[model samples]
Every structure is written in C-alpha cells, then in structure tokens.
Target chain A: MSSLGSKWKPVIVMVINDRKLRFGQIAARIHVISRKVLTDQLREMVEDGLLIREEFKELPPRVEYTLTEKGLALLPILNLLEDWERNYETKEVLAEA
Target chain B: MSSLGSKWKPVIVMVINDRKLRFGQIAARIHVISRKVLTDQLREMVEDGLLIREEFKELPPRVEYTLTEKGLALLPILNLLEDWERNYETKEVLAEA
Candidate 1:
C-alpha cells in the first residue's frame, strides 16, 4: 500500500507502463505535478521496488524509469480504478445535467 | 480518484463496510487516526457520495455512517487492492528473511 499511497504514483505508473521515459518527459506528461514532488515520488517508487532507475553515460547524462515486475502487477488494479473513476465522473456529469 | 485520494478514506471505508458505525466506533476501530482527521475524512466521504451520514436524536446526539451504493461498488476494487498488497508484503517479508 505504501507504494501506491501517493496519488501521483499510480498516474506515474500508468504513464511509464511498457515504455521508458526520462524525468522531463514524465514531468511534461503530468504537468500538474511540480518537479520537486515528482522527483520525490519517483525516488520513493524506486525505493519501494516498483520502478527501476537507469542512468546512461552520455554528455549530459541520461536517466530513464521503467516499471519493475511489482509495478507491472499494479496495472490491472489501477485500470479497474480508472474505469470506476470514469464511470463515476460520467454519472456526476449526468446528475448535474 | 479524488474520493480516495486520501489514504485514510479507503481504510475508513473498509472499517465501516456493510455496517452502520458511529463516529466514536469508527475512531475506536482505526485508532491510529486522530479524531479530527477522521471527522474531516468522514465528512469528505459523505460529500463524495461514498457514505451516508445519519444523525440520531440520542442522549449525546449520535451520528452514524454507512456506505452508499457507490461506496459498496468500491469494495470489490478495494478487495483486489488489499489482496495485491497482502501478497506484496508477504514477498517483501520473505525476501528480507
């Protein structure tokens, strides 16, 4: 539960699923999160064994994140949550209408 | 996911699932949470349409909370999350040992 405790972690996992992305790319995708918070969350995810951080030796140094097996296991649960949220939002809109 | 954005909300939902429990009872069950935080989270749950708060004209003005249809709908998802978490914890413990 600690791994998914942060609101942004699930979103991050979804964003990075099946693909590798650099910090700036992830930040660009989730524009609402501040850089500091995103950095903290990503580090926590790595510590929690949900993400792997790989650094490549290059001129400016390249780092990317990918989901570990544990993180991949969470995809279905997050998908279920996302589906539930979508339906709930639709109902809310209809009710308001 | 705003409804469940707070970690305490899920735990509260689990504690009060299928049963009408008063504020004090809920507080007693999840003793780690302070009364003020519990009150705030309960009110947010009510606003999110995940709980029904009932006021009873009793000696101390009792207030009890029960899950709404939406909240009940979340139970299965939470159950799945709980299962995943349990397995994860078990693996972590085994790895450490």
Candidate 2:
C-alpha cells in the first residue's frame, strides 16, 4: 500500500500480525508513538482494509485490532523489511554486486 | 536499520540509490518533505554509512548525494518493499496460506 503511507505501518503490522490486540496493547509495542498518531494510522489501515477492528459491548468498551487477510498478506513484506534492517545495521560496506 | 529509526529513511534511500543528487534534487523527488527534514535524514544516512555526500567549492556551492556500498546493499531490500507494497495494494484480501 505505497499510496497508503504511514511511518509506523511496518512496525505495527509486524507486531500484531498473527494475533489480535486491544487498542492500548498495540500502542504499547511501538514505543513513543502518540495516541493521536496511532489512532490516525489505525483508522487509515482499517479504511484501506488492511486491519479489522472488532468491538465488544463490554463496560469501558473493548476493541480488538487484528490483521485482516490484507494485513496478514503484509507479513512477508514486513519480514523482508525486518531482515533488511537487521542486515543493514550489522553488515559493513557490502561486497561487489 | 531497526534500532536506527527514521520515517523517511526508506523513501530517501530508494530515490538517491544509484546516481548522486544535490540537496535540492533529492528533496524534489520526495514531495512535501521540508529541507530541514531532508537535511536531517541525509545526515543520518551519512552517519549510518548508507549515503555519501560530496561537496565542492564554487560560487553558489555544490554538493551531491549517492548511496554507499551499504546503501546499494539496501536496493534488494527496497525492491522487496516496493514489490510487496505493489502487490499488497493490487491483490484482494489474500488467499489463505
């Protein structure tokens, strides 16, 4: 979703990939992101159909964020990103080609 | 890199990948990024050894930017990101497994 841009997309997608998490839980993983920013990102993801938000009729209200099929589809890409970052940080100037 | 985080890193690295570009040139490629933000991103790329900046003495001054060996190393990964984004955007809710 190149046009559907968000700085934390990769990070958030990678974290809540397989399992669903409530709002606060998701926010906790991506340290330093503001509530406003996370909320905005989540809304965009939902609109893009990348994530599904399910609500429960509980007392304080409960909403769980889970990767839709579209979101799950992003895992491999997110994996690639993680591997790339990992290698980029550890490896020195790369060898030819 | 994972620990060395930045929002614009992927975009900047993708643009100035092969050929070098001046500050203005790089800035133009990524629309809406402020010069200050671009400058900050570039400096970090240089510090992280992902980009090289060369300067020359002239009337108006001259400088160019290009990906380093490490940065070039990022191409495949960036390519993967692009492909992933493209596919994710185009494909419907992915088929299972």
Candidate 3:
C-alpha cells in the first residue's frame, strides 16, 4: 500500500485497469502527468508486480501495459475508498451542520 | 491511498488504528523508523485529515494520536490488499506451475 504513495499511481492504474494500452495512449489519457514521470511510475508499477508490460514485434515495435491479477485485485480497495468518501465522509459533514 | 506510499505510513496507521497512543508509544511500536521521519509522517497524516491530534495540558505536556473516521475508513481497503496478497497473488503463483 505504501508503494502506491505517488500522486499519479492510482490514477494511472485506474486508467489501465480494463484495457491494455500503449504508452502514448496512457500518457494522453493522463495528460497532466509529464512523460518522464509517467514512464517512471509505470516502471515502478511493473517492478511492484501490479502491472505487466508486453512488447510486440512489428514495424513500430509496439509496447502495451496491462494490470496483472495483483493489480486488478486493487480495484475493490479503490472502490471502497470512493464509497467511503461518498457515503461516510460526506454524510458526516452534512450531519455536522 | 497514494498518500500512504511511504515505507512507514502503513505501519504507523496499523499501530494507531486500534487505540489512541502517545507520540512515544507510536514511535516505540514502529521502532525502526527514525524519530524525525515519524514526526513528519504523523504531521502529514494530521494535515491530511486521516488523524486527529490532541494535546493535553499537564506538567508533562502529553499528546495523543488517533485515527479519525476518515482514517478508520481506510481499514477495509488495507484489509483487501492483505487478502489479495494472501489469496490472489499467491494462488496465481501456485497455479502457474
């Protein structure tokens, strides 16, 4: 969990969770992130066993990124976080009135 | 979740999740962490609204840290991560044989 401390790591994971994407597609989807930083984050995620990187031999030598089983497993936790904010946090604030 | 990326943040949260603890107690539980870094992490957690810090007036000037509702809300996610490692990640490895 501590391994996910970077600001963009979760966002990057969320973007790539359902579909395998090329590096350029990921960068464009998360355009606020710098190319170098996005590259670093992807590399780290791969090292952490949360992502898989595949290279296809073609005229362009395409590379794609996909979430591994370990990575897909994180989606439940992310959904719980969003639900916490939506249900618990917001409800508490409204109650404080 | 990304905010919890530090090596010590998750450990610290686990220590404080069950009961409120003084600074010394928390520091002692996660003893491998340096004092300065522990202090910094605790401060950041407070600022992030994940922790509530209370200071008592006394000759000894005591302070205690507790997880707020927001912080407590993170437990499910953390538990899911643990379950994922124990169940999914390990199962996949065992199956790939």
Top lDDT prediction, candidate number: 1
Q: Interface root-mean-square deviation for each candidate?
A: 1.2, 3.7, 3.2
Ranking by DockQ: 1, 3, 2
Alpha-carbon deviation at B49 in model 1, angstroms: 0.9
Minimum summed lDDT over a 10-residue window in model 3 chain B is located at: B1-10
Best-to-worst lDDT order: 1, 3, 2
Quote the lDDT for A63 in model 1.
93
What lDDT is reached at residue B30 by model 3? 83
Off by over 4 Å in 3: A2-5, A86-97, B1-7, B88-97
Candidate 1 lDDT, tens digit per residue, B1-97? 6678978988888899999999999999999999899989999989998999999898989998999988988888988889988888899899999
Give per-residue CA lDDT, model 2, range A1-97, as digits (tens). Answer: 3533565877788889899899999988877999999998898888777899999999999999999876787788667666766776556545323
TM-score of each: 0.96, 0.74, 0.83
lDDT tens digits by residue: candidate 2, B52-95: 88999997999999888778877776677677667765565453
Steric clash pairs (candidate 2)? none
Better of 2 and 3 by TM-score: 3
CAPRI class of candidate 1 = medium
Candidate 1 chain B least-lDDT 10 residues: B1-10
Better candidate by TM-score, 1 or 3: 1
